[model samples]
Target chain A: MLEVKNLKKSFGDRVILDGVNLTVNDDEILCIVGPSGAGKTTLLRCITGLETPDSGTFLMNGQPFDPQGTKDSDRVIGVVFQDFNLFPNLSVMDNITLAPMMVLKETKKDAEKQAAQLLSELGLSTKGDLYPWQLSGGQKQRVAIARALAMKPKILCYDEPTSALDPNLRQEVAKIILNLKKSGMTQLVVTHDLDFAQEIADNLLKVKPID
Target chain B: MSLNYVFEILPSLFQGAWLTLQIFFWTLVVSIPLGIVVSLGLTSKIRPLQWILEVYVWLMRGTPLLLQLIFVFYGLPIIGIVFQRYDAALVAFILNYAAYFAEIFRGGFQSVSVGQFEAARVLRLSYWQTIRKIIIPQVVKIVIPSIGNEVINLVKDSSLVYVIGLGDLLRAGNVATSRDVTLVPLLLVALIYLILVGICTLVLRRVEKRYSYFK
Candidate 1:
């Protein structure tokens, strides 16, 4: 569902992602592993249009994803970063419904309805009224996933979702990812979890840091 | 010092306080929206916009309010843009306060994460919608304290109207002090200022509590 080609990115004199190419298929789970500073996150960010590529072509369902020229892409894609970029000012329901209300123009009632349903499924039903700071790391990750799913995107990109959590909490977050994978959501995850990379991913691409 | 003179002038002082209240309320009503627009312009992505906003902010902030008051009340007639002294002072105060509030508002807008902006963009929210629904709420919470500070400042600054002979609270107090030759009326005027500041502090403390997540 997503195609990335010859992606090149440089910060100042150092090249982070040099001539990287990857493809993500529909309903597929791909795990990308790399050493620190390997540009795995940068590459994922480029695909999600969080950062502009120095030179690359991104295609979603054969439609062009040109960051410089296009205001938006044709496909719906959601991202969950390692830092859990929830709006600290908004409640869980507000965070989850943000994109739908703003991007999709969903009414507040409809957005709240969907947010309630999704939060319930993620085991965050009671926490919907709470803000991000009130939640634990694992719960925040679940809210992040619910936020992405609330977009109803064709592809979900995760940038090391569970890396910040402790081992026990990591497994809890892993369960959420496993559920997404089972639900047939096309997901691209940049991760260091070898077990998840080996067991759950339909494809695993190991990336090494550039010299 | 006869105390009856102070009580005799109380009715006029109250009337002047009422005028001060009007000016304060109207200026805030006018200046806040003006500040938001100025802030949006200041943060515009385009270079020309950035330049224009930069110059506007610099000009408004660099000049003294007293000078700005004189310029509005007395200087504009050189180009035939004449106004009544009261209108001139009102315009000057609104414009001056708008600039400072704009900068404060820009800080508030900056506090929202880039992630939120990107999420709004990806969701296909129009730029206006993103600002009205997403950006404004965040900005409101962020800007409340500073805005409250400015609101209190504006209450005192309204006394600057005396420079233009608009007979605001300070001018009325000045007139009363000269006639009564006592310090109580002046102290009473200071008390009024204190009361204004105290009310603003209470309201803003409540606002800060409502948005304490920002802290």
Candidate 2:
């Protein structure tokens, strides 16, 4: 289980998130929907330890998540960015295995074995040798998902996953999120696409920007 | 131009060219990595150190390298800091080129977005791992053109060793021109410099192509 309380963030007098509270069960897909400038990304950033929250507690199984220290927060939460910021220089396989091999100190053979399994799971079994720029938008998204999954996080976060996709592609991503939820992967997704949100979310929360 | 005159001087000019190549090659070997180290410092969070690097870069960039060559080779001896002719020239060139390369690397670091860092963190990659596996690879691709330009400039700048009485390529050209009382040696020197720059350009372009698959 993941929980956040009284989450607040401000940048140079403009408050982005204010007194926000959230919780996600072990078997639920929690989607946060809001309009542009509504701090949806900021909320994800805060939880992922990218943006420091002004006052909040991000707890995973009752333990506070630390952005700067230890291996727990990273192991607990992994995020797929809106742009799918895979390492451009690495092949898809390397991107997926980088964290596993480097941070986890797994051997090359072991990381590659795990990455091959995840790639096949994401339907990218043939794309291991290809670079991120070679992949289509949907393929990149799947690779980003695989990259995140390779870390074995308890909660996976997606930031505006469908915002860049066409209507058809948005549905495709929605299916992926729903499939992950069915597999019992806890997910926190922030998106403006209400249709996608409604179709996949077990519980929906609204994040509003501060005035 | 008589063939005999050209051939007679070829051996001496070749020797001088060899010295020039050594200077260019060694300076690149020493300065490129040193510049990268300095670049890391420049981008680090320490304010006082960053300030010092800023002033150093400013001074190096603002002054003519020729003046720097003179200062290190000649001016430093006023306080008992004497150096051999080659040492003084090499030291000055290394410091000057490292400053320029540091700025190039600094720009490369700046070009990488915050999103990359966030993604690395999300993936649980440590800070050094992010830099080694993710950030530096992209920075190398982005900064190739700038580095190429600086490297070619370094090839030409090696000619400045003549001012310190190091018998480099341009110095050979001068001695031959004075002895033979002709401009042919100067033409040969220019031709060799052009060839060196051409080779560097080709190599850099090839490296850039190798990394092009990223974007």
**Number of the top-ranking candidate, with lDDT as the measure:** 2
| lDDT, candidate 1, A62-148, per-residue tens | 886654333545546778868777777778888888778766778999999999998898888899888888998888888988988
- Per-residue lDDT tens digits for candidate 2, residues B12-92, read 888999999999998999988988888989999999999999898888899999999999989999989999998898899
Interface RMSD of 2: 1.1
Give the per-residue lDDT digits (tens) of candidate 1, residues B68-125: 9989988998889998987898899899989999999999888888877876554555
Instruction: Find the candidate with the highest TM-score and give its number.
Output: 2
lDDT string for model 2 (A1-211, tens) is 8999998889989989878999999979999998989998888888887878889887888888765456555368879999988888899999988888888889999999999998887788999999988999999999999999988889999999986666678878888888888888999999998878898898999866667
Interface RMSD of 1: 2.9
Kindly report the TM-score of the first chain in candidate 2. 0.96
lDDT of each: 0.83, 0.88
What value does the lDDT take at residue A185 in candidate 2?
Answer: 95
Q: Tell me each candidate's i-RMS in Å.
A: 2.9, 1.1
Docking class of 1: acceptable
